[model samples]
Target: MNVQMADAEITVHTAASIDRIAPEIHGHFAEHLGRCIYGGIWHADSADGDGFREDTVSLLEDLELPVLRWPGGCFADDYHWEDGVGPQDERPRRRNLFWAQGPEELPEESNSFGSDEFLELCERIGTEPYLAANVGSGSPQEAANWVEYCNYDGDTELADRRRENGREDPYGVKYWGLGNENWGCGGQMSPEQYAREYRRYATYVGTQANLMFDHDLELIACGFEGHEWNRRFLEEINEAPWGAEFPLDHLTLHHYYGRGTNVAEADEDKYDRMLAEALEMERHIERMAGAINAVATTRDIGVIIDEWGTWHPEATADNGLEQEGTVFDALSAAAVLNIFNDNSDVVTMTNIAQTVNVLQCLVETDEDDAWARPTYRVFDLYAPHKGNEAVRTSVDTPTRDVVDGDSNDELPLVNASASVGDDGTYVTVTNLDCRSAQTVDVSLEGTDLNEDDIRGEILFAEQEPDYAVTKHNADEFTADDLAVPADGSSIEVELPPSTVAAISVE
Candidate 1:
């Protein structure tokens, strides 16, 4: 299963589609699941004098994340907004039955990190706050109040209570998710039932322009699993004026990788199966988005893959909730990013499953130390591509039948996406073969850039023949960790199988 090098030429017509390209490809997500909130990003202990972590803040700022989703995966439905606000002393500590060990064993949640804290964190990081409301276990009044509490500035009962809590000014948060996975954890309801409930919530919430705050509200309707959900949601919304008038800005979808009882034991064959599943999910989204557009002819809606990442069944072990990111995780991430870039027109936003602890997190922390996982490295390498529109390019490589007994029999030898920034053009390539390196002849025919303007960097595991997810301590990486190529033209490069490489053309 090697990528055989050939001189087959593929042309990329950049000039023809340059005007169609968009610059806003960067987006992120944060959920209140596991340690993603309590210990992952909002650690009270890690806060400096300003009550914010310098390290976490610095990392988020570097990524320049455009938007972030919060306060739920499944936790949102069971979550009561009042539980995470007001006086910390008055807030009751409830048992987190989601991922915690036991009711009494769970840490005390003082309600200190409520809507205000999240908005403050988003403000500090210069990112938009995408809040998910509770619909499964909550009422429409609760949903409306949650919205008002964050966006209202008037002297209403909720607004007055918010002012009394300490903050008088409104956060003006815009993006509001109706609920998390309504088809599953959020609440296993039929599409018809969810749509009826969605209309009920939307009618009371009002439009984004009518909010008490300055910003506009963008309501997100949770579509069902696959295209059927998307079709059903649009049909129901189109039929009702309340649903159509509620400022439905985006439709949301969620997908994860791996499905075995143990992810660590998921061999290469299983990994390929996961990749195939992800590809199918991506295609399904595209089809579903098209179906929505067909019905909602007048409205402009986008797809938000708010929840996505590699999920191993063994994520929360007795040792801890965090799963160590490995080379396979990096490869999977690279593939996911490629899907996002390729489907930028429809998929507007995406966030890896859990930022720190649950799934493929960028930064994993312990009691005393923190380290960058392979997935984090992939993110760092691809960070520059955020905000840059993807350039349509052609890839030519031999496809092999490597699935063995798995579902997908064939996998491309090379997977890549190119983005042209203000100062340079960047191309990211991944070799999917788990056994051999790949030699790709990438031609920049559409642009007038010369060979001297191009440079390259690679991120392959130091260990040979094994794609185990490993963590790199702070000191393990340096400037040389990014393998930027020397000044050369038409040079032969070896990309380790199951590795990611980034090349820049200045």
Candidate 2:
């Protein structure tokens, strides 16, 4: 196979800082769907006999995940917090409502891993918990009580229940989502209908901030990808007596691509198309931000891509939503994370769907052990960008035309984003071309670099675009030292096709 060498230039403007990239921007999501919660995070008959899987927990702990949204994608809308609380034996075995779970692949939830178990898991991993309250089939009082149960320090029935459940002190969960996908699986409500429901739920859940806990809680509302719907939703929300003072702090939407292209049957053309779809995340963010600006100008509402990643055809609900974690998926993740870093001003936090053993999961698990996937390597590579000041970058890169049906899309062969932190400036570049390498020249606008001040790491350079990770070969996907030759202010980086590289300058 002949490899084509493309050329590109990335100019990093270190002085033009966008905003402090919230560490929570690198957050993750884990729902009851598939094995994400059951065999992935918690095992019933493990060698340790503690229910929580140490192998999985260790990997998550190492990642130092900032925030984890729990109990849902669609599951949270119908989920009643009471059913999953109290004694394990007495806890009712309810239907999973949306997804098949556990090793059995059954539609029922054992309630073995409920609120307390989840909060405990969050504590064990030192990650903040972001709980999505029920709205579709639940009541406002139920939502309020769930908050009281988790965060209230006072002596109340809900607080007593928490004490009885073995947690004497409050969990102090900071982020709370009002619902999940309320336009579809949540309730199929119109923008006005969901907005009314959101206001009602926020009235109860939001009041607890003043009436109960000393700390404040952030209320998140579900927004749609359709900008018109989001505009209408915000318009309805502002109609409340409090207007923009409504308790909403964040607006969220889910983005998942690659549903049409299966990795098993993918070629270079398919990879290009999929990569193009992944880059569409930028448009979604801008549109949502526009909607917020249009209707709720006074409110400080940030954008959150709560559920975003590759949802391939292979990862169906029947098979626990498991799919091959491929290099292509990880490359797309690199591109998306770069977008998050660049848009850190509005993109406060984004949770890839999900954390483990499911669609675009960072880690995969078997009975014996859990291993990091290619996507996990991408997250590990981009970890330095968390809490950093995002700087602007201009990339003049080659493009390839990906013709899908009647539409023609231009896919940039090279893409990059840079950030400035206390350690120094970090720049991540992705070679989106699946069949060619790209030689990229990186230049910092005002700073000159020496060889000693630059360090580079590259991932998936030795693997093909379609390469999928497995338990035995998972270790092979770890990053390797890349040769970044620095001359004056410019650094030359040779990135292999379908690879992600990170360059740090002191």
Candidate 3:
């Protein structure tokens, strides 16, 4: 059979494999900042006064979230865990130093949702918990004590404290982040300084006296998106000054797009610029992966993009409640997720920044109800690939461009990746052209999918909130909207401008 696409071409050879998409790669990040905790996940008036909304939990569960990174973005650096434990009413309230730090007694913070609350939320949602420990202003003993509280099941003071707090069972959290953005918001530390600091924290956390459980603790060092930062840090971590291994399992990198990050969207070029910038996400991964591999002592060092998304500046310049996620943001997110899928070999995990009521969030709550955003819909569609194998793909498309605040650049008209599991193969393609529909031809090398088996669904402005970027559509989209054509060797689908399509054959 022959294949030809009108605008672009995509070829999938299923026999060749990249790597299994890490379920942790489908993780979500929830910070203590803004209403994400107080008003977004925690419900004060709900029938169950345990701090979370059943509705919000159900929505996230539907998305099949694999992991939750908690209590941070930058909040991890300044947060003190001891203050947020024990009974809620008896817990001390302090000023939030990271999100909105001010002079005495401002930005009131109630230590209502502490480590236990976060662990409970993780258990209820059935996700692995990844806690970012404080390293900037925290003592090594403090970080180790936090780990002991969560993972130790023996008879120690902290363990007894955990039992007294009502949780007798150890949470057994395995993922621990050493710090966040140590290159910038974390402490403005140089790579060498942070590398030394990481050794100090990781060493004691592993050697903590009461840690009876014998489990492999995955300690991730803070890494930046740039190749230079990653390269320098990896080089520094290779040294064995204490005659011990780096204790590094992964490196954490953060990347955010849009006006404030790398590119700007405005007027007629809004969607186009945003999509082009979003396409740059893959380049960031490639460059950083190359850097990590170059200096890494072994190839086992994984990369975790713990924070990433499209952040709008004008909406956040005043630092108000997070801007409503829009259909435009959905396209950018799909593109970013596709990039992660393509780079599954190096990326062990990737978490979208601020899962609720903050930067490209999934859900927002008001005085009356919770509103599901377009980004949530994208996450739902990508769930099948959580633990699936990433089938290698080949994309051949025309280059196009739009001007942004930085410069005009050419990017692919169609960007994509493919994943295969027990159900079938899922081919996710995003057409970056915001002005016209683009034709994409996909070839599956080893699957026996017939023309009738090919199906797809699309999300775009017309099919979304339309002119209302921030509008909430509580009335769910009910239709399956799946249809595509297939020849003997290829499946073909047309994606509208600035749209994302989930094409599957089951």
Candidate 4:
């Protein structure tokens, strides 16, 4: 039997609601890299009549993912939209400049699953599509033309071409990202240089908002995690001659942790260190928000974490950036999600790295089968919080000191976030401790709760932190009934180490 060795207190401030949590906060990402596009989402051989793998599509559809960003991480920059359209056989084969793709690990793009296939997949899954345009090696005219091909409902060649390609009406893709990792893979441009390029691209892409189609597209500009770089970039973006007329809806950055800790070899100390690093997501959100408020005072640009999640050393380009999905990675996901909820007012949307067969993916697949990972369970447990109003939660939890080279850091053993909807108040809690269970006391302010009014569920209660999920054992990670003892306005639940729990009180 597991013995509880720690206690944590949580007080939900029901009245201090941040904002209606954007459903897009639960968005996902897919790139051309690895099996993510070809083998994971589509058949390994795109020439086959049924290109999409039904197993993968079913899993994604059930999750009800709000949005999916596509095309590339770095692949978007070098990609030419024209090469991906029309007949698959007639489409040009191109080299994937950044990463290898498909199950073969070849550094070439077959242009098999292109714009139409991707948008069709989104339609099948009932999820919004966010297309990132090429800005590195491609020109603004190309970016604008791609947008027209996908969104324009006119008599133009691009629009007619889209019809000829079988999509009679425009896909009406709403989220248009200008670039990806401009300071790195997208382009080796400096902050000022990228900002100028952003303006030039926006001149074509953003201006088409009223002229092109009925879809009022939201333009996303990629930013750097380095706070100073963001500050300088925003400063130059403010230099646009259009001034406040410069079109920008969201500023994005990528955050991937666990690069140092390999789950296969990590011990308890390494887990603590990784959790600490995950908690740093709060700092990134604050820093990005600060940069926006300080520099773009006149614009209401939201913050976006378009690319994020675990990128352990185990996941490299050689192997399609695939890593074993474990309970530890899922725990970190819950922590980062809580941070997103707390900052929902500014955090408009976030996409977890690769949706399938990639780093910290929610779903994993093989030739015969596909299954949900532990991280998928975490998203399932927290699904109720999506689109609900996120309220403030004060957590008083025990901490463990972790040794990080020259400095020491403390990792809280428990983390949580709460949201309120018409159904009731929902609370999610995570036990960050990997060694022992934690007894948690939750109090919903100004609300009376009885055992009959509450429904609770938990995940990974029977598993260890480093337990990697596989196809045969994936069902073991699903949420099970959690026994919560409630009295008056308080509830007490014992959370197993590295486990996640959710409570819905009516």
TM-score of each: 0.88, 0.97, 0.92, 0.98
Clashing pairs in 1: 208-217, 326-469, 326-470, 457-483
Runs of candidate 3 with Cα error greater than 4 angstroms are 1-5, 44-49, 101-106, 208-211, 260-265, 317-321, 403-408, 464-479
For model 3 the local lDDT of residue 117 reads 89
TM-score of candidate 1 on Cα atoms, chains taken together: 0.88
- Model 3 weakest lDDT span, ten residues long: 100-109
lDDT for each residue of candidate 4 in 1-506, tens digit (9 for 90 to 100): 23343399999999998999999999999999988988899987577545998999999999999999988799999999999889888988899999998889999998888999999999999999999999899999999998889888889998999999888988888899999999999889899999999989988888788776776889999998998999998889887776345468999999999999899899999999999998999999999999999989888989999998999998998999999999999999999999999999999999999899999999899988999999998988899999999999999999999999997989989999999999999999999999998999999999997899999999999998889998889989999999988768588899888889999998
Superposed Cα deviation of residue 384, candidate 4 (Å): 0.5
Off by over 4 Å in 4: 1-6, 243-245
> Which has the higher lDDT value, candidate number 1 or candidate number 2?
2
lDDT of 2 at 247: 64
Tens digits of per-residue lDDT, candidate 1, 96-150, equal 5454521122533545567777888888888888888899999889888888888
TM-score of 2: 0.97
- State, as a TM-score between 0 and 1, how close model 4 is to the true structure: 0.98
lDDT of each: 0.67, 0.91, 0.77, 0.91
Q: lDDT tens digits, residues 141-184, model 3?
A: 99999999999888899999999999999999989999999998
